[model samples]
Target: MVQQVQEVAQTGDNSGQDLVLSHVTKRFSDFVAVDDLSLTIPAGSFFALLGPSGCGKTTTLRMVAGLEQPSSGTISIGGRDVTSLPSHQREVNTVFQSYALFPHMSILDNVSFGLKRRRVRNPDAMAKEALEMVELGHLAARKPVQLSGGQQQRVALARALVNRPAVLLLDEPLGALDMKLRRQMQVELKAIQTDVGLTFIHVTHDQEEAMTMADTVAVMNKGRVEQMGDPRELYELPRTAFVANFLGKSNLMRGPITEDLGDAVAVDVSGVRVVLPKSRSAAHAGSAVVGVRPEKMRILDIDDAAYSPTANQLVGRVVDASFTGIITEYIVDVPGVGMVGTFSQNLGQRPAAPGERVRLLWEPEFSFGLPGDEEPAEGTDAV
Candidate 1:
């Protein structure tokens, strides 16, 4: 049996949010794309719809943009339902991943294209203002092919923001840029959003992008929203196995509760035991999974590891170690915990090398129950 839902009352100030998706679904023949999804995005907030390909993330965003018509349910912008509205009629603008800029048109002309179509009184003046907003005023006359990938992206952003819509939707806008440029654009995008005070709903399958730029993250799976919360909450207190495994690195331990209370439970996990803070039920108390983040695992030298607690100690042989500049990652093969990934604090140099034996420890508070999925066995202590 799954745990009962915890009741939390809603408040009024929540209604003034910019985007609302209520039981919104998109279907193609019989295949359901967006499945009765409901969500509220506040104004001036940067929100991300994150999932793997074909997980309905893009479909949900498209429904918001009025690009892909929903088969059922309603979508609203700034509080009014616009389920039947056309893309152009909604107070929303989108920047596609392809840049979608006219190749021959100059940067200024491309930005002005949307305003011109809407028959704005002074399209040139508005285009100049938009170009200046993106710091592209100096490059206004340059063609799309003439600008670098990062510059081109800025122009694309300028085009979308120029309309001054109520909400801006981005569909993998950074997917085209190289790693360095992508990193730069992430900061720039967040800065621009904060400055403009506009609601941004971004769609991406990239984990780092979702965490870094967006104020809140909504992780999706299968055609439904698996979890929705701030990035810190989603990563630290993942409620489901899919969320734990998908969002970040996790060591999942399978077992069942030996004792239970209303608010907490003691679980027997692979011969080890841990007391989880939150109460959970899984069918019977016979089986469940505990997810622990890699960073939560503390690394200790063999001597320092001697006194580790019975509930959390794990001895493992390091299969591989790689330095990633800021932090070093290691693949540790542990006996009861399996092969779990971990990281060490960067102190200017890497501490452990490949083939080293190490021990990692944490506590019961670090563990949480996940309903399904179990990994294979691994580990042998070899220095």
Candidate 2:
């Protein structure tokens, strides 16, 4: 059966309301947290603000929830200007990592709190419906302390959704749960969002969480949006080294542009010539960095004879190999490319051992060029 959030019958359709931010910025004295940023979130979409610590993702979420005012920007929800509105007045709700449920209240009462505050008719029915949406209707009579972490999170979500807000802001709502439960909640949260038809703007530092749940992900850096698109697009065709490195692992090699093939470009990384298709090239005149995902490169015996001009091959010595049942991972030391990583599926073939000379081969199109050195920030990178 299809479940939906119990919006008031008179509220009508709200699928057309988009969240728009124009020239948004937030500064704290000498520090500028969120630089000039602009983005549009379509109505009823699952959007995510992803980044490392101090990247302004949380600050941006606060601005949207009316918890923090933007230094300079206009915020509108469903076509109404609410840049300066208070949190309670805006037609939005927030679910935090803490899952701040009242200890004294029963689950049913906790879920219905927002509705009762507004004096909605038949608050019990609406709260029960919201609980059902999260598959927690049976637990409504229990206290929050009696429920598990995942159960508590569902309650928090149910509370937020009971009022049928135009936008729902989630600030790392699953951060408190264990990794396994967190993954489980990610699926549940997405399903609830789909059933309810509400815009969900999520803020998370976990790359896997954002990639797993968000329909559109905006990667933020130093208070500015570095890139925004579908998760696969950002991962496969990262425009900046920060994005490429931050989103996931990438084998980046710095080199100079050796030739421009019109539809493709050749780069010399540590004396190794690499070809990349122009469609995905970020190659700049002089120097550039070529990025390829570890999974895209294959480890082959050095004796293989077949070679193609459109493919890149590097001779390297295996520095280390880790066999994790399903895949064999290798760290190879290429002469000009420094240390490179590759993953090969475990299909009965023996993995190369340390000290073995091997060949790393991949199609040219699997590589992407960036304009500069791969200088992703060190330490905890995302918020």
Candidate 3:
């Protein structure tokens, strides 16, 4: 089986090793690409560096792979300092977005090229075993042009894994595939990493890609990490406005804290009052920005009998509505507040059309608060 081949191929002394970057920084002629970033990637873990364009995610990955040296910092693998080591000396391999395989050579030869150069014994057998691990052994005799895009990508991955590096670096490896194929590759990549048990550090600008494949995600902004955690934690309880808006859609309202009720606090947005949990609030006093995801809000008729007296309510007129199969998306404009978005499930009940008055209601515990000074639009346009 393919799993057996992977298990045997990965039985090296440096199979699972921790990668550490201490005070890593990269500067290019006065522009700081990465500023004082530090991270600890555990052994045999899937970690992703996610951000928009020019956020220093790719630069950080280059530093780890020795393609670009950090201006000031140390990179260590398995507690050994490899900051000054060259690319060939370090036990690391990288798979780029472009499948840079040799067109003139067969798939087996392409994978065995590195081993052959190093004068390793039984290069053909080792390369064949690696190809089998990726379920491409049957196509070993075919050239790069003879395979599909997905198959070529698997070949590139097999080439990287054939070396049995201590760590694997993926630089937007699935960026070139089509949407449906990209989703398929995401699942395959995660399964391969799990079977091999190697430390994988992936860099990507796609939020969904990072969330779907990585066990932990670090969101970067302006050469610094805005937030880092598991996908669910970062989505449910964002610590900053950028994270709240970047990870997904959020309805943010700025207000002043009026009262602190031990476990919760009350804030006044315009003339309306809303309650936020103390544990979920980053700003305790002064001003704060309360945020709730669109899916957490319910758009109901103004005089609906299902309205709960204890729920936080806001009155607004539906500015726009779109029926998207399973859910109806609505944009409501409140008099004192800006436009707020909400998603209501379509369960046969008629949805509020445009120009209709409706009430937006949500539980207090579902809302999170960030510092008032943070820009609510920091990451709204990132996608």
Candidate 4:
């Protein structure tokens, strides 16, 4: 199923696709926000434009929403060229981070506003059904300010979805919530998208959010998509160091060319040597960077180090340790590469203390390498 979708997306020009952006580029006076960006989102898929701020995730989304015109390239939704269409003309709706609700209007009224403006039949009934879809029917009488952040976000979702647009654009819709609420709403939003079978084109700077919600994740940098695939496909087999480091925590190692082992590019990173899963198409034997996620790395006691022969062990002195309930974060000092962190599940055993000598170990496949330390991405890398 995944392969079919991917093949169709890669080959399908404009037929039967929900959205397609070909060679999309956007720029301000001296800054290029999205450069030659191209992507296709399938119908009923939850797609995330994941990156840090200024990476053009939002800018790309704006182009899709008809809010921003790409300096070049075509933008299509439902096989229609909507690049130059006004936002109102596009069959897409956006749920903004600010909720964009009418504070004075009740929840049902808020949801019905768009339907009323479009003169949809039985606007009140549509609003009620939309509120029910979000499980907020009971609160439909309340005003925007009267609802919690989660509730307000639900109302915003209902408003956008009541019209049943072909695509739903979510631009950090939960960014304003507290941590706990944010996590809860992530599940809620995903559930809503699934239930409605709506194609969601969400943009966010949060890696975890993207991982949790997206069917396919696109990692962006400096106006270009660095890498993209399913979250696990990206996490377990990152094609580049940037994708590895950005998705989660990593102990990045850099080194000069040593050997090109057909499937893998072997190199010494500051004296430590480890073979990461190779992307034969992308690896080169130059200055290479390896990124290993912290959870994939284990902190072994000196006596236990020998037992971890399969683990790529790094020697370090525990500079700091913090018990984070679920896991303990340990900052360890490596000789030339500087400090790296490893996370230990707190439930396993009490965390090792600071100043203790330890070894961090992980399977060779846990890490990945790419062209080392290129110039930092300015307005395009993250946003």
Which residue pairs of candidate 2 clash? 51-382, 51-383, 52-381, 52-382, 52-383, 53-382, 53-383
TM-score of each prediction: 0.86, 0.94, 0.96, 0.88
Candidate 2 lDDT over residue span 1-383, tens digit each: 24345352115567778999999989999899999999999998999999988899999999999999999989999899999999999988999999999999999999999889889899999888888878888999999999999999999988987777899999999999999999999998898788777899999999999999999999998988888999999999999888888898888887788898889888887767889988888664677788899999988877756644334878899999998989988999988667888999999976799999998889888999888655633222432
Best by lDDT: 3
lDDT of 1 by residue, 1-383 (tens): 00100000011122244788898888999899989999989987999999888889999988888889998898887768899999989878899889999998999999999889989778887777777777889999999999998999989988887777778899999998999999999998998887777788999999899999999999987789988998988888777767777787777777766776557676776666666666433323656677778887777666663564656667788888878877788888877667878888888643766677877778767766766454312111120
RMSD of every candidate to native, in Å, equals 8.3, 2.3, 1.6, 5.5
* Tens-place lDDT digits, model 3, residues 1-383: 55655643475766437999999999999999999999999988999999988999999999899999999989999998999999999989999999899999999999999999999888898889888888999999999999999999999998998888889999999999999999999999999998888888999989899999999999999889999999899999988888888898899899999998899999999888889899999998999999999999988998889987753789999999999999999999998888999999999998898999999999999999999897877788743
| lDDT (C-alpha, whole model) for all candidates | 0.78, 0.87, 0.90, 0.79
Q: Residue 286 in candidate 1 has what lDDT? A: 59
Ranking by lDDT: 3, 2, 4, 1
Which residue segments of model 2 deviate by more than 4 Å? Answer: 1-11, 304-311, 373-383
Question: Candidate 3: misplaced stretches above 4 Å?
Answer: 2-9
Candidate 4 structure quality by residue, lDDT tens digits, 1-383? 22322221222232244798999989898799999988888988999999987789999988888889889999887778999999999878899999889888998899889878878778897678777777788998988888888889888888887776778899999899999999999998887777666688889989899999999999998889988999988887666656766887656677775776767666676676777656622447567666677888888876663564642578888999988788888999988878898888877664688888888888766666656764212222342
Q: Pick the candidate with the highest TM-score.
A: 3
